[model samples]
Target: MLSQPPVWFILIAFIAALGPLVFFHELGHYVVARVFGVGAESFSIGFGREVAGWTDKRGTRWKVGWLPLGGYVKFVGDLNPVSMPGEEKEDLSVEQRRRAFHCRPVWQRFLIVLAGPAANFLLAILIFATFYVAYGRPETPAVIGPVIANSAADHAGLKAGDRIISINGSATRYFQDIQAVTSLRPNYSVDLVYERGSQLRRVPVRLGSEQRLDEFGQKYVVGLLGVRPPQLVYKRLSVFEAVPAACGATANVTKMMVEIIGQIVTGERSPKELGGPLRMAQVAGQRASLGWSDFVYLIALFSINLGFINLLPVPMLDGGHLALYTVEAVQRRPVSLRAQEWAFRSGLAFLLALLIFTTLNDLGSFGLWESVGRLIG
Candidate 1:
């Protein structure tokens, strides 16, 4: 059984994990805006009161905030750090208007907003590629060691020593490929091709699933094939090979995220599986405790997740700004201030509600909610 992590350890790990990622993400925005000659009023990591800060020669106030939950780049001509538009030419001199983010062309603004998420994706690729160069990519042949009795593989006539070649038409060159295809697809039927005794055979099987709790008691479902793996293998790749492979790995992670989110939105998966800061802290601590390598890998994974989430078409996000810019591009006019305000309010409220729900879920994972209720009674 996994034991609960210490609170202080979790807190430290969470901060260590989030701080750099946040900096890199916001740095993306700041750099792109600078390239387009748009000035930033403030660049901040975290929220609320300033812990430490300084002003740069360019007149940008850089700071670390107290909350440490999220960060933002407040551009000139923005109402607040969220980047809503401020007063136009009437209140500003010619130079100020030129450097104002709102005064920039729609196309430039779109790319500037997009750069944040783009940086995240690029960071993930670089990290993965670095690992591939430093350490050989680990993989093993798709050969089954032992089939679980009365399990999906067993029911489908799969046995030990069988080599999987493909699943539903996609080649499975390695054991990792097999895992990538099946792990997110709980209870799904697929055509699996494997070589057995010099003969190729196909079998159809519905995957099995089980609910398990992590070290911190966060629950999740994962599809199972019920087959033991063979001996490990690691293949060193050249720089050229590593970069493309890294791209493929990033794409695979993004695809899995999309599929899982689709299931959750469609009610196929429990919303309770959704997690917020506390769940993140637990996982971060687990990774930190394991080793620096594992913790760094977690940072890469979370970077991709952060990129994907910010790209969602919700109001008050980078994607939301992009969406509005898209509309402005097509319609040749910006959205009305009243409409934008209404949308922002709705988005803010929805995000707050989600935060509350996920926090409650986190507390329940630790049995804190029940304990509080019992105490109240």
Candidate 2:
């Protein structure tokens, strides 16, 4: 059985893991904004009160905050870090107008908002590519070893030695590919292509699912296909091969994020499985204790997730900004400030509710609620 790491280890691991990810995410926005000649008023590494800071020659106040949870970059003439509008259009001098974020063309604004998530995806890709180039991808043939009776595969009329060629029209080149699709789609029916003795077959199978924990105790609600793999093999890639492989890996993780979030929202998965900082800390510590490689891999995984989450179309997210910019692009006019404000308010409320719910989940994960209940009884 895997045991939890020490509290101190978890705290250190969490901070170390989150800090750089936050910096890179903000840096994406900062660099792109700078490229467009938009001046940043402040580049903050953490939220809340400033712990320490310095001004650059460009006059951007670079600061660290007491709260190490997350960070933001405040652009000139922007109301807040979320890039809400603040200053009136008429109040700005020509110079301020030149530096203001809103003054930029809609396409530019869209790219600027998008750069944050893009940076995260880039980080994950680089990391994965490096690993692939050095070590290689773990591969197993997409041939099934056994099909448990009465399971999804059995229901689909699959048997041992059947080679899965594709699922839902996507190529399943390896056993992991089969898993990547199936794991995220519990209770969901999928169209699968498999080959047996030179004959191809198509089947629609409704997956059964089970709750499982990884080595680090990360819980997952994964689809069960009732098919087992044969063994493990590592296929090293050239630099050219690694790059595309890494891109595919990044795309796969993002797809997983979208599917899992959709499942949660639709009640196919319980919201209680949602986690917050504490959950992250525990997992980080476990990975850290294992070694630097594991820790770095966690960083890559979390970075991709950070990027995908920001790209969600909810208000107050990068995706939300992109959504408005998209509206502006199509209409040839900006969304009204009043409408933007309402969206922002709604987004803020939604995010707060999410936070509260996730915190409760985290507490329950730690058995805090159970402990309190015991005391009450």
TM-score of each: 0.92, 0.92
Q: Which candidate wins on lDDT?
A: 2
Give the alpha carbon lDDT tens digit for every residue of 74-142 in model 2: 998899988988978799899999999989999999988899999999999999999998889977899
Candidate 2: segments with Cα more than 4 A from true spot: 146-157, 185-189, 204-213, 216-221
TM-score of 2: 0.92
Compared to the true structure, candidate 1 yields what TM-score? 0.92
| Per-residue accuracy of model 1 over 186-205 as CA lDDT, tens digit each | 78898899999999998998
Weakest ten-residue segment in model 1 by summed lDDT: 213-222
Error of 1 at 147 (Å): 2.7
Candidate 1 backbone collisions, by pair: none
For candidate 2, give the lDDT: 0.91
